[model samples]
Target: MADLYRRTVLVTRPEPGLSDTGFALERLGWEPCLAPMLRIYSVPMKQAGAVDRVIVTSGQSLEALRVALPPATPLTAVGARTAERARTLGFTAVDYAEGTANSLVGHLGRAGGRNSVLLATGRKLGVDLAAQLRMNGWRVTRRVVYRTEATESLAPAARSLLEQERVAAVLFYSAATARAFLDAFGEERGLLGSVRALALSPTIGRTLGAAPFREIAIAPRPEQQALLALLGPLPTSDTNTARREIAP
Candidate 1:
């Protein structure tokens, strides 16, 4: 069994997601230190008119929309989680593709008959989706429904773990989050020599740039479960030993 401290991981996703991933890590017997690198803010947007369909890339976009459109509006989501969120927000017609913008674009391409589509997304994001859909004969209207800003610094717990060199890995969910983390801690890249950098996608992994991590691994799929799988299973004996010491 690895030492308790050696099993620690730094979670760099923003809240809601941060808590969810941390809880999953705990269930897998890994210690997770919550460290949100980005702050998400809802950007109020006005829908000029109704559209045939709406596309959402993240749950944050749906939350920002505030269900302004009718509940029966046909919605296409980038992933199952976003589709679930759309349902929770009262949208009756919802469907999703594999967890990536490219997959969503392909899914729409295969669906035939192009129509006016509203792309609900974060500020300065989703350009590729809009462009691809337009190329495929869909009139796409892109709306910035939310904005993400980099936090000023790492959480105290995350900083302490890095300083002690106890963190085994750092999980990154988005390129924005990874960039935000770099903005906050780029000067200390050397500290990551013994830390593994785990990213949800290749794009996110590339965002880490030249950070001297012991290794950098990208998830096979752009989903939380795939990202967590990169950490492998924790030993049962270590799970019990760490649980007793770390339990609140």
Candidate 2:
């Protein structure tokens, strides 16, 4: 008897980077495919200010701000990964909260004072951290660090894999990615039924709406590493392997 998930696995994260997940799936003996639903690009902030704190929600935002902001400025990150990215860029006085926009805002409200806070974010962001901070009376500025765009085309092979029952799971990192994926699949909801959707957070799951076929799985934390950990099992046998194709 073999494990059930050796079936094909699709990594449908919005970001173009799927090497990490690709390698992980290979290690588990499952075929992996890359079908990124969204692409991220950054636009730098034009002005400078001596602020109380800066909030970074995504790793890309942290990378963008590192090149523009002073190294010594106080910073708070939405998660350890973002904080780690900050540290790599020489931001020493950094604070990290649980990896959620709300959690990050709450921590900033308690820790950040009247100093003008800069929020580096996407062009179309969910859960406005800046708005939340302003409501709490902290001055906030936003730097559009990135843009997420849906891919115009999905790989034919990946599309075929998605249409068939080859995909064992679908991974979503953001709400935007979820919406774009659903759109890409069109009427192929039947394939989704056989797949388990692994969302990075509860918020991502909510954006997916009521799909008749797929069972949604959420990670304890909003991180890729956590998603893998929560799924358990190393996926050894053929039954455990999934035919996976990623669309970016």
Best by lDDT: 1
Q: Name the lDDT of candidate 1.
A: 0.81
Kindly report which residue pairs in candidate 1 clash with one another.
Answer: none
lDDT of the candidates, in the order given: 0.81, 0.72
Tens-digit per-residue lDDT, 1-248, candidate 2: 22343366677764423666777776767677878777877777667567777888887686678788889988988888778778988998998989898887777664344658888788867346777877888777777877778876667877786666656677777787788878776776555666778889988888765575457888987776888665565455434444444435
Q: What TM-score, over all chains together, does every model reach?
A: 0.91, 0.84
Steric collisions counted per model: 0, 31
After TM-score superposition, what is the CA distance of residue 242 in candidate 2 from its true location, in Å? 11
Best by TM-score: 1
**Residue 238 shift from truth in candidate 2, angstroms:** 6.1
Which ranges of candidate 2 are over 4 A from the true structure? 1-6, 14-17, 27-29, 111-114, 234-247
